[model samples]
Target: MNIPKNHLWLWLPFVVVVCAGYFIIPSNTFVQELVAFGIMSLSISILSVFFKDWRIYSLVKVLGYVFLAFFAFVKLSFYNQYGVPISSSALYVIFETNSGEASDYLSNYFNGTTYLLLILLLWPIFFLLKGLFRKNKFQEKPLKRAFLYKLFLLLAALGCVFAIHKKFKTENIPYATLTTWDDYLTAKKQLKDALAIPTSKAFTKIESKDIPQTYVVVIGESTSRWHMQLYGYGRETNPKLTEIKEELVVMDSVITPHVHTITALEKILTLSNQENKAPSPNGSIIQLANMAGFTTYWLSNQKPVGLYESIPTIIGSAATHKRFMATDDYNYDIYDGALLPVLAEILKDKSASKKVIFVHLIGTHLRYEKRYPKMFEKFQTPSKDLKFQHEKAIIQTNRYDNAMLYNDYVIRALIEQLRRQDGYSYLAYFSDHGDEVYDTMDFLGHNEYHGTRPMFEVPLLFWFSEKYINEKGSIPKDIGNRKYSLIDFPHTFASLSTITFKGFDASKNVLDSTFVQRKRIIKDSLDYDKR
Candidate 1:
């Protein structure tokens, strides 16, 4: 021990650990924010220190760099694919740039710059280690070094195994295909690179117009109209909205293009379908809005940094953008009320014209208690799992129902403010998808148990002020069965603006009157292609 410590070679392990922390802390936060991540990173780095083979050291460095580089690119690619430009400055503030934010932020915006920095730091180390070992600078028994090396190998091995298991293992699996290291390498690298390329750009140039008026699009998370009393549900989940029934157009049975907000919003703003990522912006909502004359913006509570941030492009196109804004408050951590005032202030400028703002809420995001203020915690069910306790599941459902109550109120304020504005007031509200809470033998939140992805069944509402509604014409008030999804979003808006463009893909647009039948977004991959 003393000899290894005295030798410069002994410090290699310490370097590995320090470097690991430097890479992770600046990029990804953990479940409990970054404190937990630091502990985990230190443990893995120490494992590296225990290994003594020069080749093994090289493998670790190369593998870590390869993995981290893919990670950074995936984050970056996802951000850009949205066809929106998320401001690097806003990311720095929300992320604390150097300090980093919570583990939760990674799902929200593009911040892969940190990972790129990490890859740069490790490249030199990789070369140095390779050089050090090739020179045979340390004299030691191969057996002893090999012994140290195997122990170190065990740590790296375990880390890889755990990650694979977490992602691939399912509760009901008798067996699942074990993905190879090569598969992970290929998958992530492709994900990152595919998005980075210009081929994925999905929006048209939107020119800023005369007179600034902000159009706020509040994208609610995990809310279905069936759960809302405002739409014909039995419960009183939307007492505020129901009270003002005259102002609401609660579109019932509005299915979303994708179950998740990431994919659904992509369809809404980009005007693309489930078939592709950017590379085409012709009929996208962002393109349509820009063409119709309006500034587009996206503010989220999710973190998509790097490749993942591409989803925000639905709101920020080449023609329209104010950059994406996120609070990094996932898990419903940000209060539903926080977005309203910020929007109100931004819209106050009288000189601005037809500004379209999209607010992606953390509304009803997991760990239900955290979704609302502490006072709301009183509504937690008697049992946490609620697996066997039907009573507790019902209670948890009630808590979520209460959150819906809060959402209705929050939205009411936003619409009222818009009504007071001096322009053509219209509000098109839609949930990316609905949440199960406790339905179908499952606990709160969306999951596969709800048949495919639970996040796809969202509630969509398009509200117009009295002046705008009367000036135009009213949609048929009959409660006839009409299916709607985000695919109709572009067509619906285009109907209002009446702009024609070749990029518009109406081959599947549901808003087209001739297409009386509504189609489900999810396809039956097997069993005869029926959805």
Candidate 2:
């Protein structure tokens, strides 16, 4: 065994690692990481003197570069998405997302700046590895003075760490990130396992009061009413819906409880309300309608492939019939119009006495270009007629309004199809949650921590066939003008389906005259009355 007497070159990897860590992480984290890396360097340098082979030293140098590069990449990506460092919540979202969601991000949100940042961060490490591997050998002999200098630097770093320790605690510096990842994965698995167990309980006390009919609930995605022409926006984004305004019952001042898809939909489909907000598996609108003897169908355009099933998928599984259009292709432009044909088939089936169909449309989720066909790209630029526009967000706003235009077509098509059916048909349309596509802020996606008002403000519309209106009497003239929250949806759906049970509350139903408007709550616990 030959040990190198001088080993100053061993300190180079430590310097690179510490410098890279400081740059990649947030400013608040730099001091703690610098101190940790300093201690690590001292331990490795002290132990390197006993090395038996020079090849081991070269291997260590290359591995150090790989570690630095990996850490930098993770930090950059996390910061870009969340505006904060990596944590348990961020890890949960990243690991739980399906492949389709991931593909959507890469194709749409992965811009040149992110790619350039990654390249800049990794280039130095690549250069170091290339040089080390080219020689096929590592520098083992280091000048004694250089070795002493490295030791002095470590001591200086330790002193600085002590100085900052009084001001900022170093509690989270050691393995918090890794622990958060592990905890998130474990919790997610437990949740998935829980949701997998069948929890649909038969309602012992339920009855149908009105004539059996086809009731359709069209759940849209990430569309705000602010972008729609039907809502008095300057853009002509809703040509179809606007033309048929006399036939539609457009609700006013409606907001969803949550800016997130799963959270908002769970409340909409279940007996969950603002006062008693708990995810109830057995009491979903689907279960109640099924208990009331209505044939249930769940038709969706969202991805059906993923390790962890989405809550919507879990709830949809209880339906009697299910059809999913895509197998995790989120980037491709398979328009929401595809669901219309499947819906045509469902409407064609006259075998059932009654039917309750849940049509989940991928309406205007991110990558707006993929949501609609090219023909719906009407608002590409600022028009001379429309006044409200921002240069920074105009292009994105155009794409979003274009998506809304496409949404208008698909929704109206569903309504027209139901009208053509020979029965007391009814339809309700509402978005899962509104998006922040340059509405009140220059932001694009949901922000759970500080969500904006436009993030909750959504559109809720209804279309009742002439037969149902004539039989059940006209829908309250003021039903469309009522201010309501998405939490009222389950009760309203019950009214639309005419399913009466112990869980039915007319006061919470938006369509009922007894309906009461209260302070809207968001993110489960925040009061949004003033916002």
Candidate 3:
């Protein structure tokens, strides 16, 4: 099994190229690069042995280098522009872009750094070509241990297959691209089917009082009640909301049925609940409001694309008018306050006698520091009661608290803007789900597999305008303490708006007199309260 030194050294160029490319890409990890190197080396070695002709093997090897080098360049350029890897959303946008738009993007993004990265990525070609040109004797005759060598190669191929399967299960670039493409196609088909379903079939009857009224639904993201002063946290993360807590119905026991954004929002905004896990045949709240003769508006600060078309975006499209502030994924520069002006403009519209507005905020999502402005960085240090004492955990806690503080300002501003309006309006604010930022565990993000209390306990607050309270009576004495899950959000929303249709369950409405306490299930399996 002795091999020539020249033959062994030939594969070194491929390994070096792959490792360099991975190191340059921000999204790739050290372990991923190492595994990728192993797979590449083993594959080339096996192929070289199988292909008896040296010229054909060299051609195959060069083709592999070309493929890897092309993707590496594209990924590096994308990272330079977006500070993130190329995602499905990015690919979707690219494919949808016209020639003019593509030109503009190239002109804007392709700069000195991009060219430098291309140059750095191209250096491996020289080494590869030099090694290919150097004359090395190929083993044309059968060796003594040919059977053993073939068996070893077979085992190596199986190991590579196992590694590839494991890597595909992760969030690596190759897996992301393939899965995103599949999801994009599926979502496109679902969106088409949903659009074809008539609004009339979704409801038997839609009845509401013919009066000038407005309802605002604010959907927040990754905000936990445990971190807010309004919920009795020691930090002043909710100073603005705390000042007017008396006027707001702060629902004390509300939780989301899921932790992820798309799953939780699909249930929250539609009639789909734990009992009915399938897509709701009855349309979303926006469609319901539209059927009820209210001019609906959907304004969002969150990106519309989550890998593919997010469920929230699909549902939001049912509104009479929809505007998403962020065009691309991971563009966190846009703040929630930007949505306020749009809300104000929508509130001022006089053409519609009745109005239902949905505002989605990117409140306190991961990379917490990017969620808020520098001025809102109020919490510089972590609290004394933090369970994890590491510097990174402490920083994350502070950043999250600061983001919460900014969110407080945004929510209070929304209430005040609605208060100045002339109609009977009530605004409901709730997060799609909460985050685990050094709370109950050392985790900083939400994971359904590793469920925790803070990841499901979201803040649900309601602000009733003075005129609305006078018209609809005072807030219920026991409404805030009612055990609630956001799966019944549309039912409660209908109750608040005095709207009724077929299949509307009064017991599911937290504010209704027939409201009943049901088991709050999370992740489709565990009881949230019992857990």
The model with the greatest TM-score is 2
Cα lDDT tens digits, model 3, 257-336, are 98777778878987767777655354688888888888888898877654235566777877888788876443345578
Instruction: Determine the backbone clash count of candidate 1.
Output: 52
**Candidate 1 global Cα RMSD:** 12.9
State how far residue 229 of model 3 sits from its true place (Å): 0.8
- Stretches off by above 4 angstroms in model 3 are 1-50, 53-135, 139-184, 195-200, 280-282, 305-308, 328-332
Q: Give the best candidate by lDDT.
A: 3
Residue 406, model 3: Cα distance from true site in angstroms: 1.0
Query: Per-residue lDDT of 320-385 in model 2, one digit per residue for the tens?
Result: 788888674667776888889999998898788689999998899877878888878777766554
Compared to the true structure, candidate 3 yields what TM-score? 0.73
Q: What would the TM-scores of all predictions be?
A: 0.58, 0.78, 0.73
Model 2 stretches with alpha carbons more than 4 Å out: 1-68, 76-82, 85-87, 106-116, 131-199, 202-204, 272-283, 306-308, 383-392
Q: Residues 1-531, candidate 1, lDDT per residue (tens digit)?
A: 323331333233334334543444333321222232233344344454454675675456445444334433333332333222223222322232211233333432324554544455445444545634563433243335466666666766676446445642321011121223334345334434433322233433333334434466677877766567766655666767777776666666567765555445555655455455334323445445655566655555554454244444323433343433454434436676777777777667655467666677766654444567655443343434333466646666766766776777787887888877756667767787776655443434443223333355667776676665665566554432466656557656544443445454443333343545444555212111154
Candidate 1: TM-score?
0.58
lDDT of 3 at 289: 86
